[model samples]
Target: MKQLNKILLFTVLLGTIYACSTKKDTVISRNYHALTSHFNILFNGEEAFKKGIEGINQGYKDDWFQQLPIEPIVFDDRKIVAPTFKNNSLGAGFGSKKEKTTTTQPAGPFEKAEEKAVKAIQKHGMNINGLERNRKIDDAYLLLGKARYYSQRFVPAVEAFNYVIANYPNANLIAETKIWRAKANIRMDNEEFAIETMKLLLVVTDTLEADLPNDIKEQANTALAMAYVKSDSLQKAKKHLILATRTQENKAQAARNMFVLGQMYANENKKDSAAAVFNKLANFKKAPYKYKIHANIELAKNVVNDSISSSVLSRLEKLIKDRDNRPYLDQLYYQVASLHEKNDSIALAVDYYNRSLRAKNGGDKQKSFTYENLGNLYFKNSEYQFASSYYDSVLNVSTDSLALRIRRVKRKYKNLASLINFENVVATNDSIIRIASLPKNEQESYFKNYIENLKKQDEEAAQLRLNQIAFGANSSSLQTNSKGEWYFYNSQVVSFGKTEFQKIWGKRKLEDNWRWSANASINTRNTDSVNVSKINTRYDLASYLETIPTDKQKIDTLKIDRNQALYELGLIYKEQFKNENLAIRRLERVLSLNPKAELVLPINWHLYQIYNKNGNLEKSNTHKNVILSEYPNTVFAQIIKNPENKIENKEVVNEVEKTYKKLYYLYKKGEFKNVLVNVNDVLPTINNSKLKPKFELLKAYAIGKYLDKETYQRALEFVAINYGSTEEGKKAKEILKQLTKE
Candidate 1:
């Protein structure tokens, strides 16, 4: 009787399960599907969606250098979409090759959430007579839309959102879905449509009607603000952004919205409005740490004036000293540098710029901007070499979007390159000429002193290496060294080592392979028969003297090259750089060198212009009279005679470039002699042309291939000095260095 009762109970349970059919519109079927969809499938789907959003928040980095975007999503073409549920032509368990491939591949959080949503819709959706009885079906569609939106598939995401709105118009989350739809529209760059739709959504869900929840109202306002921002309507954006912040469910987004709104006001020069916005954001307790920090920075920027400069600087300095603000040290340092620069405290500005560069964990864009500022500061101070280095660093890290700024920097760097090259030439040639002119005794004394210095440097370097080795071998020694215990701290041990070293080596040179017996040249076969005492040639005065130029012709050539560099540098300073003092200095040195007839008139004309610009008419007339008297028929004289008369050498410049290209082609084809002949002929005709550098460098390359090493070096040296800042000139300098090594 008990076994019969158990069988009857099992039969009734099976019947009850079978009776809950999805095709039937009974209360049992509807409740079963709704509960399963909501509690099981939709619950997991929502959790996965939240996880995906968390991942995105963790990874997304806002570019603070530019206007921040509304959304934090940055999409890539990495995800492959899987087949949808509606395509049921294939069996429920079967799929095509493409679908199978998609299934086998690992999916990201968004894709996993999307998969769960699709599963809920396909399995639990109770479409009885074309009406979804499962209440959670609308939620599943909303989830699907959100996943697609974040995945950057805006069109498909819109389709999913439209389905939710069309199928379930009275759904509790309809207002939220519309806001998502508008956001997707903004992302697609249809800001006009997004703006209109968002406005309509606001009207439909008006607070006066009591239809919209506070969170939904905030989402709608945020969407509308983003739409306006995208359309370049910052004023309209500010109103909505303000409204959005008042009822914000997401404190982080609200903080960012406020910050962007403040930036817009600052951009428009509405400092008071911007200050009010930033002040509030800075004091917001629930705001993200980054937004709050930047808020304080923006607030300080707004109040930067003569009276408040001290206070502002103190505030930034306090932030810098705080350990919690370590990650933002680069930006803080940059701001301090900018403030010092504005106040004309140039030395402090330079110090702060360097500090910014050395700060840890800085963004590349921040570093680029800092480098550019430092470069500009040095450029203004006439420190071309330092400026060139900083500008080069900026180019290395700066984004390609800054096309105009990059172009301007390149132009300045090119001009500075020339100055650097000529400066190097003057220093090098001056040293050589001065040393070559000294008497033999004085020259010998100079080399002996130089050798002594060289010995000291080498010995110090060798000792440093030895100390490093000793420290590495003994851990205790490293610890002691770190504590300021020098390797020579024990005077007795140091004296013993020094005495022992001198006894065995007899003041041997510290160099590579120094300990080898072969270097000592002692005969191991007959040690007693050979003399142990021998001089190292590197330490001998004659060895150093032999390297100096004794030939008058070579020395003369160097003087000519140095003079030409001075002439070019003068023109660059006066014309390109507009530095009157440097121009005067360089041109005066050229005249003192007794420059060639060809260079004399040009150098004088440049000095005349510089002095004239400086209101030193007496000095200006001196050069003006010289140019008119010495080269009356020249272009310089013509220009001086009539200020309106321009030197239109466009055709000549074009012809010079064409000639250089032909010569370069011949050079590449191994026609070295032809290249040399053409370059020499063309160079004389275009002596004052900017394209002269190209022909000169080509001539050097041809000489390198066809002439002796000494002549090749002389040709290269000429190019290096005459066109130091040019691309061709830099190549010549590089080649010269390699030749010296060889």
Candidate 2:
């Protein structure tokens, strides 16, 4: 009986192995492969794909300040290469600090999913007589294409999708596969082909014998919308977005489409249409919390008017006060500030902008806008110090200097820097003159009070440091030792001692008797018990009084500097800023201070231009006569004599300098495309200008950034050969040598 049972088990095992052979086209073989791919391999692949999508959604931050793209994931233009799955044990580079610590970057979820999809196809796929018998193999190909798409490898993704469409034409997922292929084409910058393919797919689906599912139709519409957006065809994009929203298959996606549609309408100034769309989206219950909140904000902005302003304000305020909307407070506060600004309540708007910045978590782009708004307010009010500080903050937070908004801020900051320097020089000179004119007693009293305030601030800072040291002492992990060793051995205690020493003795050189300030000059009188009176010269009153200009020649020099600063300030305000009132004030002050002979003519010319622009003919003629009669042979007089020759020789020089300055700034900001375009246009016009060599060199640098290395080399050679005598040409020659070595 035992022998018979063993033989029966051996026969059953052999039969099972033969029945499941993949080379055969039997029903058992096909079902076995399909079940293995579907129930096991494909299931795991789809889960990893879902996780990858979630990762992308979590990592990407939407820039609410600009028009949002249809797809949330954006491939970095500078990082378009295929992602590597290998571990970076070498770190950033050899001998770098990062190389000291080994880091391993695991394979991303998309890569794992791709690996699983490949496994499913290679191990379980059944191909007989050039026909795919495994029904689940098409799904595996679709999964492979999706994995590549999310990895930003568009060419590979397109090929995978094409394989399924070409070989598995009658697959159940054929329509979705085609849609993914169209999306990949759009990503590859082939928007025209994507648009045509999407349109054809829609037409074919509509004419099919079977009714197309609404979800499939929704995807097609979404793909077409993304294609149109890529091509900058907003009108066509609006139609597809509207269709996508109406389908409502994916609630979150539909909500996004509706909001984008409203933004498009708002951009085109169709407020009623925009308000309708936003109002519906704002009330969408199934949408994500962020989308719903932002939708409400958009609705309030579009529909707010004199009659409904109060209502809009009430709604925004209500949202802000809600505890559930805490995470969205930054955006809510910013919208409220914009509303107040539109109503001309600038003070209230400023308060709300500050409140927005105080939110626990605010986006960098949002903070930049707030800082820029405050800077503009101060600039309009002629508060140059405040404006300059706020503009500096904007630049610090906004790292993308290539953005148009950042470029504008950078230019304003550069111009403001010159004005600030002039203002500082004038202020310093005026302060010195005023102190010198005062009585000796008054000067002594003023220095004493300043010293007292400085000492008080220092004492408060020292006390704060002591409090921090006490806290550290209680929490320190090190065991305490005897006093002889404790002060030097404990790091925190030693740090505190160094701070105290520096505070009292200031920074001193390591030498014998370093405490004595007069050691180098008076080396013989160095006894410690010789009644040494150590007066810290930094805080001494005599040090302040001795620096004041008391000599007539020195006083005159201060006045001259003050007058020069006022003259330049007048010109900057008049020519660059167009502040006629400020210009007249500053220029007139220069005259009162008795400016030099060379400054007299230029100041008068600027005063004449400003007053004449303001229609004050009486004031204009008074200064104009000074230039015309006193400096008759000057270019200013020549220009006034013949108004038709408005483009004076100096004007040509100024134009070239100004154009070069703008191009240089654009190059610094990495706007190479615009720099190249403007350089090409201006080079043809300024063929005779002395600054022509500078423009040629700038064009070469732009080519290096915006085009290929070979093109850059050719451009540099042109500059080196044509204008070799100029400084720019010499610099270009050096760069060409470096390129050759590379």
Candidate 3:
């Protein structure tokens, strides 16, 4: 009886509201979609789109791009210190480090779109449902689908689009809904399905209104083209790309389109057409990629090399020298350098190489390569010292590239050994002079000052050593989260606690060095030492009796510290930065300080290695032979046996470096896309070498030159390991670290 009464009441209400509802439906359908779809201002994803694009642009670099783009900011987690690039700015970008409550925060475009769609749906959800219910409510569903699509909720977006399609068969927006649905399918890797549906969109062809928007058609075609490209359907890709080009209207956008098409054609060896499109793009000053200036430079090169026409040179100069284009000066300088090299103007080339180096900033990987080329040039000119110097620069920045480094070192070793021999002879002859020149008081004073300096250095060294150990161990735990930066987070609290702990207790570590002693240790510390060797008449002068017995102990401690310092110096000089002379000095100092048994042979081999440079060939071979006879089975001797044998192991890396060099060369030639692949290949093995930081830092710098922040951050992290201790490394670690966080 209740069900019957409800049905009777519902029929009465439906009849009562039918006339009013009919009038409303007609009004709703006529205006909103036909004029202002959704009847409200669209959030449009326009701001985000522009911001993302601008952010990328601000970050977008090719070879010479020099601008600070948006940096990644870590929210909390004080222990995680970020890296910086240059000393130009520090702590300017990241958020505070108060134990980072927001690691994976809710952000990104699609999320906003999805949220807005949901809010809109909630505001007007469902209306009438029967035959009389207006079908135009499907637009909200389309909005939902688009919102989800923007938010990257592809499946849900697809569902919303599907809802509009299935529920509103003859609705005005059926075409728009289908296009959105197809795009979602493309993202899901349902390319074939998307292509099929896009073709279905053709079935609605009548008026332009009856069909999808030209922009929608263009997007659909592009989606299909990319699908073809991804599937390796070159012909289809070209066909679709051409289709897109014809319809693309925005001049800058169209230029971007043409540039990409040209790049694809160039990739496929269709040079003439590629040249044509490049020419077309170069001619268009209105294009937004003016900073790139790539097409202009390349086309000019093609023209200049073919015939050194004044017009081509003028065009090239405009691209190179324009103030707006100065950010890409690395490429410009390199191009000019190449032209000088091509003209057999070696000195001019060297000058240009230096200019290129200066112009490179940190963002150009090709600049490290400038060292190699310049080194080669000097070597060819038989300016061995100059070559060695250039090689040293190359090695310092080119870690992991053993073949090139070894070769340069071999050359430099010859020169260094000759100098060492000269030093040895000079030292032997000058011994008498040194002794005769110094009076007793002066000698004593000299020794005393030397000892004091050594002591100070030792203390500083010990502290640094402790710092390294702390960094490698439980330092993370002691760290507290502060605000904004992860590194600063809770650091004050940690600092306070560390201070309090040190105050209450004495310094107690099993390890030997402990200069960062507690207050108690300081209070109970021994007074000034007395030298028993210099004592006078005994009148309770026992205060001066402490030194004679402890001399051996001090020597042992100094010896140990010196050796450790040598090992660090060796790694730093050899693997970290390739400052061979500094490496050699540190290693030799270890021997002079009489390091233990384990260190002697390695030091000797390294000395031999260092001596093998250009001017010291005889000495290098002498050391090599000495190592061969003495430490035949050691790693150093193994390298000495046949430098040629390592060539194959060097090949993958050789190819990797070669890729960068080639890209740099192409970059010099204004071939940006080729440089892209080179960056990709070399990017994978940036950390593979002892020179990884140098290479990786360069790579990140290169990527930062032409690409986006996200990619630049990625490359910088791999480099951070190599640079953590260095000033550049420190900067790189902080900068790249932040980027990684972002």
Candidate 4:
């Protein structure tokens, strides 16, 4: 029994020692756990950094990578912002170079491993008990900061880099830390801070200790170049980039720097320097600045065709076929088109122009400019009708449609008219030639039916092409009735072109029901605009052809049509469009064209109003004096010479109505601009008169549309403010304001 008790004591003592030994072993293992033990945990980040650099250098095409916006991953919060990376953090087979123990990491990205390292630090940043505490923690934090910085998150990036600086003063990566700190500063748009940090790096460059790696020095200088590029200081960029290109170990990176240097020189118009660099890059057979090959073609365009020979064109043609060259076909085709056009090769130019149009999809703004150029080329060659149609095609996409279309269409119409007449002249000349050459009877037979057939064919084709394009531009929307079938409304998208352009000066008849029922007078504002342009074109063409034709009858016929158009324009401006100045100008041109009696006092009264509105006090007073003095009983002069003496307000309405009755008679007699002025002088006094609003709007329309700039402003403002409730009043306000703003 005593022996059994001793044995129990021995067993209890052995149990206690065994327990202590097990606890110590557990503590040691926990303290010395190798990185290889957590291989999956630490392999992510290192693999990521390596793969990212490779993919970047591989020249990212539209991969899952390039489409993404670059988002940096931050550690403290373990959050990733947009441009989030895609696929795995690193693909399989990373970190194979490192040793593989249990804690030996599986090869993966630096980023993935860094992630593990980060998690470890987050839990133990201040816990200095283990081997991975303090310096290792500091290194992990610095590594984490760099990873975030490379991911393009400047704000969070700045935080990570700043952490390393604050916590790792004696760390081995301190020099790298300083350069990275500068890099972060550059990304933050703090170039001054970056420059200061970089300069300090330079001072440490030739340290007595002979310390940091040359690659780090190279990186620091590269950062300096980037900072300069951001600041738009190309000279500074050139100096530093030159250092990197020469001193850097990486040939591809050096090539990239050279390409940038060339681009900078190209932008500054230093062509020779640019050309040399580009040619060198072009010869670098495996260079990856894919866009650089495109610039060489542009540079070729500036080589000036002093001889305009086959060699230059041949040289250009060769450049387009380079296998690495198809991406910039738009530019290639444009230059070729320009070259062909310069060489007087119209068909070639047109073909290339079309190619250029087709070469790009929606990628370029140059497309519209190219189309307009082709249209103008055809226009200037006097293919007016074709040019006009081409310009219309341009208008479908053009931002400046109104002004451009009018200019094109008016030119087309005038040219078409002239072309028709020129053909007649040609026919007449051909007839004279035939009569001179043939027997008289044969001449008549030869000329008569041939001219007739040709005329009919030309007329049909011209009418068909013009009408189709004009009408095709206007498409309709359908409205369905309760009966169910839809009926199309006549969509009135007017192809007014020259007609509307003419209204800029005024020339249409007062079409019936043209005005909204809100006012007394008929409105032919749009119609009037159309007519005026036609009249002006008619006048111009007829007068232009006078000297070309020797026959008295031809000149006389031309002169008659010319006079008619001028008178029409004058009347259109004075009455239909209501531009007293335009009316006066048209009337004066009519007088110069020597029109028959109808356009005289209309001209004088228009002159009177235009002068008054223009603030030409002398001309206004003089015209009033002339009318009151010479044409004494002329009602217009009397009204102008005596505003206060005239009856006004409600009484003025009756009085002016009577006066305007006589003025309307004058208008009917075609003194429209004069009647407009007379009507205006009395409109203010009888604002409530039914006659007053009509005449006020009419006068405002005339003055605002063509004569006085500010008269439109004043009239619209007054009508809108005083008669805000009336529809005519609102329209007058809109049109008046629009006219004045113009």
Candidate 5:
């Protein structure tokens, strides 16, 4: 009887297991699939989707200087495709080195969620009489769409979203799915489609009184703003961004929207409105630290009155002193520097700029701005050397987006380089000439002093080496045992062994006959030999005297070059830099040097203009009369006598243009030599005219066409240096750069 009862229980268990099969549509089957899909598969999928979102948010770094995207999804401008799967079986002990390796073997969380969603739909989805009976199937589809969207598979994501909107119209997640589709469209550069779909969604939500969730409304509004932004309609974008900011679903996104709205207002020159918007963001307690800090800085920037400026400075100082704001010191110091500059406190501004450079966690962009500001200040002060150094720092830290500004800075730096080089040459030559004029005994004394300083430096270096060796020896003795077996581990012992071995055997290589001094000498033939007992000529008094230039022709040539450089620097300061004081100083120095007759007229003309601009009428008239009376036939005097000569000069420029056209025609007709001859003849006549660069560039082109590479390069370099400010000069520089690469 017990065996029969056990058999009945076993039979009942089998029947219950059979009734749980998903093939049937009874209550047990329906509940089993529904429960399994919702609780088991869909639950894990939803968790994975949430974790995927968290991962994306953690990885994304927003550039707050630009408008922020509404979502955290990182869309690559490059095309993305689904990864192809390959199952290659390697031989027993062999694998291809070309095989790719990744840290994470499986897909990311979103991809995992997508897989699970597909699995649930394939395994547990209930389709009865052309309807999905399992309600969780719609959720699985929504999860799939979201996963695909986050994974940047926009086309697939759109397809998934479209499937839901077409087949599951009455589902609770339909509105969200439509919003997702619109966002995906935007990602795919379908802004118009996205805008239309979002508008329809808004109409439907209002017409049906559906009462969509706040997050959905925020998303729709942000999407519309993004669409308008893509279309370059900032006014429309501002309206929607404001609407999105009010929804308060995503606080970070709300802060971003508000920030963009303020930037738009500022762009439209609505300073007060922009300041008001930024103030709202700055005062918001829960905004991200970045947004809050930048908003505050923006507000400070808008402070126009002295009273408001004082308050802003105090606030910025307080921020700088706060320990908790240490990470933001770079930006705070930059703002303080800007404020000081606005107040014309140049020294304080420079100090703050240096402080910003020293701050920790300051981005390259911020450092670039600081360097640029310092460069501008020094440039304004006519400190071209210091300005060039600062500009170099800017270039090191600046991005390609500032290409135009960087090119301008680089051009200015080139001019500065010329000035600095010529200034250094003049100063060095003057010092040398002065020293050369001293008596032989005094010159010997100077050489002796220089040699003494060199000897002292060498002695100090030798002492440092001895101290280092002694320290190493002492430390090694303490660490090593008395046994010679541990000698190899001691650095001092190793060094001593090497030195002693070298002294005895002379330098040798690790090869046969290394002990033979003759063989060693032959082996070390390529190595440099240091002979301590040998006297260097650089330290000898006679060699020093020999280096002082004594030839009268060489001295005169140097004076000529120096005067020419001074004259060029004067013109550069006058025309390029617009520093009249510096130009006046340089021109006066040129006159003191007794410049050539050709430079005197131009120098006088520049000084006259400088004095005129500075309101020194007496000095201006004095120089003007000198040019008019002494060099009346020159272009300088012609321009001063009648300003109408400028229009006549344009006619002269037209004649030069005709000459250039004739030479260009010769170049095209394969008469390259004639082109060169004509260009050379016309260039000197137009040397004082703006057409000089044009003529020189034509000559360079003709050279490139008719001459060897060296001649061509020389011609191009001449054009680049002499006419650096012209378009033709820029083209020459670019061509030279391309040739150098080849």
Candidate 6:
């Protein structure tokens, strides 16, 4: 009886397994496969798809300065790979694993979702007698499309979306599939097609407005707005963004849309409208903290001086004191600084700018703006060194997208660098020359004092070394016991042995002559000999005195260089820095040095301008008469004769322009060598004219076209260094950057 029962149980199990086969065209087989696919495989697939979406959203960082995309898909243009379907379902957990441990294995929740989706189709799909019976196949396809979309495989994602749209037209996910299709189109740079499809989706949804879900309506509207934004139709985008925000399904996106709408109004110069929109966002209770904070900043920016109330300042102060807003202090401080600047409270503005820089978590963009603002402020005050320092900070923090602004800052900083360099040279040389003019006894006394200071430093350094060695020896002793007597077992003893050996043998390498002094001598000869020679020279007072410049011709040449640098610095302070007092001091020094005849006219003219601007009529007349009597044929004399002769200067500019036009035409005609010769011939004649930069730039271009790369680089470098403030010079710098990058 037991044997019979076992046989019967085995037979019943076999029959049940046969009845569940998906190939059978029966009620039981179809329902069984459908239930298994929907409740088991497809259920897990949908969950994986949702997790993938969460991962994407959590990883994406929105740049609030730019308009936000409807979806948070981060696309990588270099990662275009064809989608391959896996047969095994074991890899379905790929999307759920947050931490990836291996590079060789496939990862990401989206890839897992795709694997589960493929498994469902392959293992449980039932198609019998030319008819498909699986009910959850459409859901599987929907999941597949979304997984591909999030994975940044747009072409494959489109194929999946198209499959669902073509094969499952009456499915519940058809509308969503269409929306996904349009999004994929936009990512593929098919904005026109996306726009058309979204418009059609909108019309269909409008007809079924009562039946369609609110989230669907919101998605459609937001997709249309993104499409319009891509096409640069901000007005049209604003309308759709308004509709999308009204749905309130996605609070973060709604806040972003409202902010972009306000920005659009600001861009169009609708100050009142922009203020109203930003104020509405600021009052929104559920908006993200970032959006609300930035809205308040926009409101502050739009505040007109005539209408600014006490409440405005009070509101900003209250925000600054709020502990919860600490993470956003960088932007808040910058906004406050801008407000003070607008009110002409320069001291307060500078304080706030410094506060912004001191904030712990400031974004690079905000820090760059703060640095640039400080640079501009100091530059306007004629503090070129301080301004250059601030501008350097700006460049260090600025991003590559700020190319034009970076160019302008670099040009200004380069000019300031030149002025600073020449000023330092003049000051240093003047001090040296003054010391050199002293009597021999005084010079000896100065050298003696300097040598004494050096001796003191050497003594202090020797004492420090002795203290460090003592500390190291004590530490080594503490780290050992009686075992320290063994050189190989004790680290300190081994170290001491090595050092003593080196002191006697002088770094003898392991070789046949292990103890011969001459064998070790080769190792120490080069470095030790030089160091000993330098130490001997440094300690000898006579050697130190001999190092001072004493040749008459060399001293005279240095004096000339000093006077030239001083004269250039004076002109820079007057014209570039607009600091008349500093210019007067430098130019007066040049006059005292007995500057050359060529420099006297310009220096006197500059002094005249400076004195005239300061209302010193007597001093201005003195310089003006000198220029007129001594250099009557120069441009300075002509300028003094008729200060208001605009027509004459205009005519001179017109002639230069004509020359530039002719040379530029020749350049365009491929006469590269001729262009170079003509530009050089015309440059010296227009040394002080405004057209010199244009002529020099033409020459640079000609050199680049006809000469070797090294020569071209040198020519561009010359323009960048000497004529950096001009537009042509900026172009030269940009080209040089490209060449270097290549």
Clashes in each model (backbone N, CA, C under 3 Å)? 2, 0, 54, 37, 0, 2
Check candidate 6 and list the clashing pairs: 95-108, 95-109
By summed lDDT, which 10 consecutive residues of candidate 3 come out lowest?
Answer: 66-75
Compute each candidate's TM-score over C-alphas: 0.74, 0.73, 0.43, 0.44, 0.74, 0.68
Candidate 3, 206-276: lDDT as tens digits:
34436566776666666666666556676787676677667665555455556666667676667677667
RMSD of each: 9.3, 13.6, 22.1, 20.4, 10.4, 11.1
| Per-model CA lDDT versus the true structure | 0.78, 0.81, 0.56, 0.56, 0.77, 0.76
| lDDT for model 5 | 0.77
* 222-277: candidate 4 lDDT, tens digit per residue: 77887887787769978877776655465566666766667677677786676676
lDDT of 4 at 367: 60
Task: List candidate 5 segments past 4 Å from native.
Answer: 1-30, 80-105, 300-302, 399-402, 438-546, 612-615, 632-742
| lDDT for position 180 in model 6 | 86
Model 4 TM = 0.44
Worst 10 residues of 5 by lDDT: 88-97
- C-alpha displacement of 379 in model 1, angstroms? 1.6
How do the residues 518-556 of candidate 6 rate in per-residue lDDT, one tens digit apiece?
Answer: 344442467546522122445456776776688888778
Best by lDDT: 2
Worst 10 residues of 6 by lDDT: 88-97
Which structure is stronger by lDDT: 4 or 5?
5
In model 2, the Cα lDDT at residue 477 comes to 54
Query: Mind giving the per-residue lDDT tens digits that candidate 5 earns over 1-742?
Result: 9999999999988867865564567786677778888899989989999998888778888775555665655678576664332443211111233464333433788988887787677677666666677777788888888888887887777777887787788888888888889888888888999999998887777578677788888888998998888888888899999889886788888888888888888777787888889889988888887888888888776775788789879988987888988888888999999999999999999999999999999988889889989999998887888998998888888786457777887777777887788777777767777777788889889888986687567546655665565456656654453334455656655576567555444566788844333344443334586523323454456778778777888777778877877876776777677788888998999887888775676678778988988899999999999989996765567668766421223347677778778888888899989888887566545546777787788888988996899778767866665565568877987898799899
Which ranges in model 2 have alpha carbons more than 4 Å from their true place?
Answer: 1-15, 23-30, 75-106, 126-131, 152-156, 262-279, 296-304, 307-312, 323-330, 465-498, 501-531, 597-605, 617-742
Q: In candidate 1, which residue ranges exceed 4 Å CA deviation?
A: 1-20, 23-29, 76-106, 266-275, 297-304, 397-403, 458-540, 628-742
Model 3 accuracy (lDDT, Cα): 0.56
